[model samples]
Every structure is written in structure tokens, then in C-alpha cells.
Target: MNERELQQLTEHISQQFFGKAFRHQAVFNDRLKTTGGRYLLGTHNIELNRRYLEEHGREELIGIIKHELCHYHLHLEGKGYQHRDRDFKSLLKQVGAPRFCTPLKTVQNKRRAEKRHEYICTGCGRSFIRKRRFDTSRYVCGVCKGKLKWLRTTDSL
Candidate 1:
């Protein structure tokens, strides 16, 4: 959804769940990498990752909104608003909000199974992992200065 829709949704969620009006702005932030949404402590504004909506749909988006709203409402009321705070936990349970922001599944999988190229030293028999392919003829082992040979490929999950 667009920024205007996001603003309206945040406001609606705040009122419906927290019984509090959301006075600050809510917008989509494309730069948000892993987090579903974030609550700005200084401005009391909410920034949501647009990818979350596109990937997970409206239900996940609503859950993220509720989670951020918990932080927004608790912080504004001078209550414990941090993730570890008792008041934050209580508010989250009351609203049925998630304790932690849900990360994008693709990102989580990518992080868990980062692709790596395995190479072995011909002279020393030592192994090395590189993210990018290198010219075996040009590059040598750092430890033994021996020729590197491609061994196998593995996912570093």
C-alpha cells in the first residue's frame, strides 16, 4: 500500500487496539531490510517495510502494525516501551501483538544459507571458503602460497 494508506491503517489500528489515537505519521520505508516495522522513539512515527506487505500480505502487515503500536503507545505514556520491559510484554499480550518483528522469509533463508565456494590448497591441503569465484591460476593460498584447487560447493546455513 501507499504512504497515505499506511498512515490511515496505523491510526486505525492504534485506536482499535490501544484505545489511543495515533497523532504521528506512518510511512513505508524501503530501506528497512529485515524488520517488518519500526517505531521511531523520537518522532513517535512508524516506518513499515513495504516488502513485508507484498510478501506476507495484510494479516502480517496488521500484526506488525500492532507490534509497532505497542512501542508507540507505551513510549508516549512514559511506560516501559522497550522489548525487555514488563509493560511492553503486557501490552503486547493484551493486543495479541508479536514480541519481535517478523523478518522476511527470503532474507532469513539467505542469511542462514549463504552460498560459499570451497577451495583447497594443493600443497598444504588446507581448505578455504570464498564468497566469489576467483581465477585458480592467479590466486594462491595465503598460508602456503600454494595453488588453490576448487573442491566443492556448500551452503553455509
Candidate 2:
């Protein structure tokens, strides 16, 4: 759906679920990487991750909207709106919103499958793992001062 549909849906959900009208904009944000949605405190607008709707479907999108609405409504009402607040927790439970968004599998897999450069000491057979590739010729083993060689990298952490 477009931004217009999202705005209408947000207003509908706010009235249907909370018995309140949403007075601000609700739009799909392409820049949101990890979160399903976020409530902008300054503008009182709600930004939703379009990836969420594409990956998890309409139910999840609604849940995310509900979650952000919890933040939006509570913040506007001058109640405790933070995740740690009792009011936020109660409202989430009352409205059946998820406390946390599910991690995107593609993102999680990319993190888990990071390429780690491994090195082994010839003398001690000790292994060292690093995030970046390093020249073994310039660096010696710390324990035995032995020559180091590049080893095979693992697929997962």
C-alpha cells in the first residue's frame, strides 16, 4: 500500500482499537533497517518499515502499527511512553501488540555468515580469528613468536 493507505489504516486502527483519532502522518519509511516502525516524537508521525509488510504480511504490519501507536498515543497523552514504562506495557498487552519485532531472517543470516579471517601459528597451532584480513608475513604469533599462516574461514559464528 501507498502512504495514503497507510495513513488511513493508522487512523482507522487508532479509532477502532484505542477509540482515538490519529492526527499525524503515517508513512512507509525505506530507511528503517531493524525496527518494524518508529514513532517520531517531534512530528508526532509514525514511520513504518516497508520491508516488514513485504516479508511478514498484513497481520505483522498491523501489529507493528499497533506497537507504534502505543508509543504515539501514550506520548501525546503525556503518559509513560517508553518501552520500560508500565503504561506502555499495559497498553501493548491490552491492544495485543508485539513487544519486539521479529528479526529479519536475511539480516540475521548475513550477520551470522560473516567472513572471519582465521590464522594459525605453525609452532603452537594456536588459531586467531579476525573480522578483517591481515597479512601473516607482517605479524608473528604472540605466544611462540612463530610464523603465522592463513587458515580456512568458518561459515558461521
Candidate 3:
């Protein structure tokens, strides 16, 4: 749906679920990455990722709106609006809103998993897997305190 429809839907959900009117703007933000939607702390406006609606459908969009509304209402009331807060969690449960939105397939596909670097201790013959490479001369093995040698680098599964 367009921004107008989104604004109307957000207002409806806020009133229907929280028994409060949403006076701020709700717009589809194309710049949003990874997140399905975000509640702006400054303006109290809700910015949603349009790609989420396109990829996940209407129900997902509704859930995202509900999630954002939870933040909107809680923050306005001066309660705990962050995800870790008790108020936010309870409100999310009460409204039947999702804790986290499902990741978009396209976004998931674009992210590359971190590669692991394999190393072996020359003296102890012990294998080590690290996220980043370290200098063999500076660092020694914990077991035998021996020099380390680079073995192989593999993509993390």
C-alpha cells in the first residue's frame, strides 16, 4: 500500500489496539535496511521498509505496524519503550505483535557469512579456528606455546 493507506492503517491499529490516536506521520521509507520498520524517537513518526511489504505481503506489514505502534504508544506514555523493557514486552504480547519481523529473502541473500581462518600449531599439531588471522610470531599456542602456521581459510556455513 501507499503512504496514505499506511498512515490510515497505522492510525486504525493504534486506536483499535492501544485505545489511543496516532497523530504522527507513518510513511514507507525506502532507505530502511534489514529492519522491517522503525519508530523515530525524534518525530515519533513510523518509517517502514517498503521492500518488506513487497516481499512478505500484507500480514507481515500489519505485524510490523503493530510492533512500531507498541513503541509509539509506550514512548508517548513515558513508559519503557525499548525492546528490553518490561512495558514493551507486555505491550507486544497484549497486542499479539511479533517480537521480530522475518528477514527479507533478498536481504538475506545479499549478506555474506563470515569466513573462518584455520591455523595449526607446528609443535603441538593442534588446530585452531579464528574469525580473524593473527600474527604467528607474536602469538603462541596455549597448549605447547609453539609457533602457529596458517592452514586454510573457509567460508562459514
Candidate 4:
């Protein structure tokens, strides 16, 4: 859907679920990487990740809209709109909105597949973990002036 459809959907959802009319703009935002949606406190606009609708369908999109609406209504009313606030939590439960958005599958995989390169000092036998491979010949152990040798690489979440 386009920006106009998004705005209309947000307004409809606001009225249906929150008993309020949304007076701010709602648009699909391609730049949103990890978040499903966000309510801008300054502009009172709601930015939704387009990938969410394509991947999770309209149900998930509606949930995200509700979540953002919770923030919008609370902030506009000068009530606590943060996740930790009782007002926010109460509205979320009342509206059936998710407390947190699910992380994008690709993003989660990239984070879980982190690699660590291990090296050991020849003289002191000290072990070090580095994120990237290094030139062992050019670098020495921080202590004992020992030559560093590649040990093993590990991958972990």
C-alpha cells in the first residue's frame, strides 16, 4: 500500500481500537531496519517498516500500527508513553498491541552468526579473541614479547 492507504489504515485502526482519530501522517518507511514501526514524538508521524507488511501480512502490520498509536495517543495527551510506563502498558494490553516488535529474521541471523578469531602467544601462552583476522607476523603479544599464532576460530550467538 502507498502512503495514503497507510494513513487511512492508521486512522481507521485508531478509531476502531483506541476510540480516537489519528490526526498525524502514517507512511511506510524503507529506512527502518530493525523496528516494525515508530511514532515520532516531534512530528507526531508514524513510520512503518514496509518489509513487515510484505513478510508478516496485514495482521502484523495492524499490530504495529496499534503499538505506534499507543505511543501517539499517550504522548499527545501528555501521559507517559514510554514502554515502561503503566499508561503505555495498559493501553497496549487493551489494544492487543505487541510490547516489542519481532526482530527481522535476516538481522537476527547476522547477529547470531558472529565470528571470533582466537590467537595464542608462543612464549606466554596467553589467549586473545579478536573479531577480525590479523597479520600475526606484524604483531606480537602485549606481554612477554612473544610471537602470536593463530589458535582457532569460533562462532556464537
Give the candidate number with the greatest TM-score: 4
CA lDDT of each prediction against the hidden true structure: 0.89, 0.92, 0.94, 0.93
For candidate 4, which ten residues in a row score worst on lDDT?
103-112
- Residue 88 lDDT (model 1): 95
1-157, model 1: which lDDT tens digit per residue? 7888888988899999988899999999899888888999878888889998989899899999999999998898899999999999998999999887666888876676668999999999999988987889999989889999998877766
Residue-level lDDT of model 2, residues 5-91, one tens digit each, is: 999999999999999999999999898888899999999999999988899888899999999999999999999999999999999
**C-alpha TM-scores of all predictions:** 0.72, 0.82, 0.83, 0.84
Instruction: Put down candidate 4 lDDT per residue, 31-73, tens digits, no spaces.
Output: 9889999999899999999988988889999999999999999
**TM-score ranking, high to low:** 4, 3, 2, 1
RMSD to the true structure for each prediction, in A, is 4.1, 2.5, 2.2, 2.6
TM-score, cand. 2: 0.82
- Clashing pairs for model 2 are none
Off by over 4 Å in 1: 112-155
Identify the candidate with maximal lDDT: 3
Which clashing pairs does model 3 show? none
Lowest summed lDDT window (length 10), candidate 1 = 106-115
Better of 2 and 3 by lDDT: 3
Q: What's the best-to-worst order under lDDT?
A: 3, 4, 2, 1
Provide backbone clash counts, one per model: 1, 0, 0, 0
